[model samples]
Target: MASGLFALLDDIAAIAKVAAASVDDIGTMAVSSLDDTAAAAAKAAGVLVDDAAVAPRYVVGFSADREIPIVAKIARGSLKNKLLFLLPGALTLSYLLPVVITPLLMAGGAFLCFEGAEKLWEKLTPQDESADEDAAMDPATRERTMVSGAIRTDMILSAEIMAIALGTVEQEPIAEQAGALLVVALGITALVYGAVALIVKADDFGVFLARKRNGAVAALGRGLVIGMPTFLILLGWVGLLAMLWVGGHIIIDGLAKFGIGLPSDLLHAATEGVAGAGSLVAWLVEAGSAGLFGIAVGGIIAAALHAIPRKGH
Candidate 1:
């Protein structure tokens, strides 16, 4: 009877060891998978940052209370763009028409170039637009317009980010690809909109602080309120720069995939040449060269667009 009991205990111990080993294996696999997914996500950082930087513009005219709610709605729409629409579409494209990815990426790049060029043009050709127009609109109407515009912009950036992420994913099981994409999409959207919420509310926080009796705190709050507009403008410019850099990089990479690798090659050589100078210097040189190339390409395209005649009988 004692021997029987000992045998049973040994059997239970063996089972426990097996379970522990299985759990460890799963943990190891998950860690490896997460590392790969993170690298892919990092590759799409330019688009992600641009998305976060651009979203605040859409909430410009809203009341303080409306800012967060509007951002939440836009964030929801962005998620829908990624999950309900883009995920299935991307998967189908990956499986059915793998060749289309390069073309699609190039198209998105062209779009980014066009948008950046348009913003540059708008800046160069200033118009005195009336704030009263926004002031006159009902809150609901304004909110709708802002949400629509934001979603449209988000669709473009989201497409680029999704494509980049999809491209980086290995030819793993479809489930793994899906898992990586979902992680990237949710992570990016949360990051962008969460930052947007903080940015939009920052001035209000400043105002609250300014009401405090402490002189230094009130002064700091005053500075914050005063600086917010400039900071937003700076953010807009940074977004444009990101668009240009990301757009140019995508086009260069796409062209290389299609066997036109000269541009990227030249950029790479330039980057390498600057490497001996210092890390920061090398990076700036590379980025500046890329940005200049992007600007030139964008300008040429913009010029060609202007030269084309509009259709009107």
Candidate 2:
């Protein structure tokens, strides 16, 4: 009996040792996955910034009290779009249709170019403002419609973000790809809406501080009040540039993969040399070249589409 009891204790000890090893293995995998997630998210930085920049426009006409609520609604919709809709589709493409991913990414890149160029086109050739459809609706109704519209718009951007993110991890195991995309979707959604919440409420916060506080605090409030509009305009310009550079790079790089290498050659040549700070210069030149390429491609696309005559107006 004594010998048997000792044998049972030995067995328990061995099991515990195996369990500890398994736990360590899992911990290592988790860390590696997180690193990949960060790198993948970085590749989509352009869309992420534009998402943040474009979100503010949705809240512009709402009452102060409604701003955060509207942002919250859009945030919820964006999450649903990423996690429920785009995530599975992205994973499916990576697993089953891996070959199509590059062409799809280029399509998205072209879209970004078109969007960026269209914005420039609008700026250069102003059209008479159409009356807003929501003008006749009650405030509550208008808010509902606006929230729905914003969500629809967010669906497009969220799809792009997910596609760009998944493209980065296409070679990883399916589980790892899922892990990276999950992190990106959750992280970016939080980042974008959190920033939007802060932006929409800055003026109110400033007003509160300006009225209810004094001295340095009050001066800070005044500064926020004065700075928010300028900050927003600057943000719009930044978003445009980001779209152009990122979109252009995607197009030229994709073309290189298909044996159309001239644009890619230009991109490479623009950044081919570097010594010390020249690396920084190389990065900028590469980005600038991509942006210019985007302008050319996007301008052609924009003009071609514009030439299509409008009907039934």
Candidate 3:
């Protein structure tokens, strides 16, 4: 009896040890997975920034009560874009048409360049007719137009995000890749729209504060009301810059993969030249050079697009 009891205790101890080790293994895996996902998200910052920047325009004309709801709707569409559409499609592409990733990336990059250039062109050559048409539209029609435009833009930005995520998941197992992509999609959707919600409400917040009795509080509120519009305009410009920079980088990288190495070569040379300037300086120099290349490429594409003639109505 004594011998048997001692044997049972030993068996229990061994089982506990095994369970502990398994838990440790799982914890390690979770950490590693999260780290990898974060890195990939960082790599796709361009798309993320552009998405945030573009979403606010969708809610511009809506009543205060409707703005958040509209943003919510767009966010839902964005999720469907990634999880329902892009995720499975990306997996298929990875296994079946891996070679096409570079070309597809370049295509998306071209799209970003086109969009940025279009915005710039619109600003420089404002058309009174279009402005008049917009001003003439009823609230419902304007809202519809804005929602459709936002969804269409979301499709392109979502595609770019998925591609960047897919590229980063190359080494992971298929299941892990899918999980990571879903996480990234949901996370970014929440983040972008959440910020939009706050931005849209900021004016209301300012007005509420302005009604308060305290002079300092009213002054702060007035500042917010005055500053928000400028901030948004600046945000739009920044978004355009981000799109061009990111798009250019994607095209250049894609080109390098296909044996055209000029962009990477230039980046490397610049990095080396700035090596003695310290790590931060070197990194900035490399990024700045890449951005310049992106701007040049975007400009060329914009010029070509303009040069093409359109059909008469």
Candidate 3, residues 1-313: lDDT per residue as tens digits?
Answer: 1122223323322232223234245455544555444434443666666677778887876789889878888888888888888989988887778888779988888778777767777767967664456668888888777777888788889898778767765555566556656666766677677777887888999999999999999988999899989978877777776677777778878889989998888888989998999998996786567667776777788889779998982
lDDT of each: 0.74, 0.76, 0.72
lDDT of 2 by residue, 1-313 (tens): 1122223323322232223234245455444455444433443666666777888998888778889989999999999998899999999988898999889888888988989999877767978779877778899888888889889888887887778767655766777667767766776677778878988898889887887556888888899999989888877877787788878988887899999999998788768854345777887888788999998888888989989989974
Ranking by TM-score: 2, 1, 3
Which pairs of residues collide in model 2?
none
Please count the clashing residue pairs in each candidate, in the order shown: 0, 0, 0
What are the candidates' C-alpha RMSDs? 12.0, 12.0, 12.0
Local accuracy of candidate 1 as per-residue lDDT tens digits, 1-313: 1122223323322232223234245455544455444433433565666777788888887778889999999999999999998988888888888889889988888778778877877877977786667677888998998898899889889888888777755354556557657766776677678878888888999999899999999998998899988888877777787678777777887889989999989989999998889988986777677677778778889998889999991
Which candidate wins on lDDT?
2
TM-score for each predicted model, relative to the true structure: 0.84, 0.84, 0.83
Could you tell which candidate, 2 or 3, scores higher by lDDT?
A: 2
Q: For candidate 1, give the lDDT of residue 127.
A: 75
Model 3: number of backbone collisions: 0
Give the TM-score (vs. native) of candidate 3: 0.83
